[model samples]
Target: MEDIMRGRFSRSMITVAVAAAAVSAVLSVSITRTLGQAPAARPARVGGKPNFSGIWQANNEANWDLQAHAALPAAVTQPGIYPYDYARVPAAPVLALGAAGAVPGSLGVVQGDGQIPYKPEALLIKKQNAEHWIDRDPELKCYLPGIPRAMYMPYPFQITQGTDKIHIAYEFSNTARTIHLDKVAGPPDDTWMGHSVGRWDGDTLVVDVLICATHNLLKLFRFGWSPQRA
Candidate 1:
């Protein structure tokens, strides 16, 4: 009888140990799940509408291209010491470099002089473009001026919003406006702004420029193509 009592006590102790081990495992899983899944982060919203209220600058070293500037290579894998928030943007060569070939305005921008971030082929193209810009951009050649170029002109521009339509007015020569938003791509007419349509994604304004001037001219691009050394 005593031996039977000892066996029963030992069995009960083993059962308690198993239950405690099971509880510990379950607790660990629950804690891990709770910590790993984070809450979704939402963009800031205002006035039942998304607000895009940042001052955009047109003057930067990237005016020539979107990659890198002189002493700033396209293949650079690390950040530089200078603060280049707006400087990453390409700036026009003539404007960045003064008459004496001095980079007066590009002190914080170009680690070297006013030279831009360009591949060899692109550099050749830019040199040709600089020579002919007063006469022949794709817009003047009757094609869409492309998205980023139009957005980053030296002349100031503005964006106004209505219930369904958004307007972008340029201080450049064309005096053009992009009719888009409200899911509108505009009529099929080719334009410098190229049927730009915009929409709101959270607090950001998403704009799509259709019929970009990759290889063609717009009906509005009536400037004579100068036999000027293309």
Candidate 2:
């Protein structure tokens, strides 16, 4: 009778081991099948066009000067003494900030020859504005940076696409603009952020912008004049 009981116990232990192995094998197959499935797809285009919905920002010094420029000690500079005349020093307004006020260099973002095609008179005005930028730059006063200028300002902007409009929200001065993809009347008055009309050119979205004359304090640099395209 003792031998019979021992044999029954051994069979019970074997049954338990087989049950555990079967569960583990079932779990392994389930895990394998799950890992083999394809991942969920992300939307690459909207309404049969490329999607432009996302946060964007410029990573260059185009906001300083759209044309190619070498790094400078300061945005505001004056001639140094004697042999160092070519080596300009920072002007009083930015002198105290030292390296912190220095201008960073860039290869420029101009589409063509990397130079703004400013007329002779406009060129002179551009120089004057650069000299007095501390007082003249609208950005210094938390003013709305107009198109293309708003595009490259040292701030991030968000793009949201709609069925008939594309909206851009800029971090600078909390400015924003909308691109009309459908027909609409122009703004009754000129605006600081300007009126933007947009259309699809193949996969590219082309925008036509019109800014107000009052916001032209840096007109030479604004109005899509610098870097050709931002």
* Best by the lDDT measure: 2
How high is the lDDT of residue 96 in model 1? 39
**Deviating ranges (above 4 Å) for candidate 1:** 1-47, 52-56, 71-144, 215-230
lDDT of 2 at 214: 51
Candidate 1's residue-wise lDDT over 1-230, tens digit each? 99999999999999999999999999999999999999654334334566432334577634333434343222111233556643332234324333422222323334565355455655555555544553445543444354556665455677655556666676666556655666653556544445666677776677666654434321112122211111
TM-score of each: 0.43, 0.73
Cα lDDT computed for each candidate against the true fold: 0.50, 0.77
Model 1 Cα RMSD, 1 decimal: 20.5
The whole-model C-alpha lDDT of candidate 1 against the native structure comes to 0.50
How far in Å is the alpha carbon of 128 misplaced in model 1? Answer: 7.0
CA RMSD, predictions in order: 20.5, 12.1
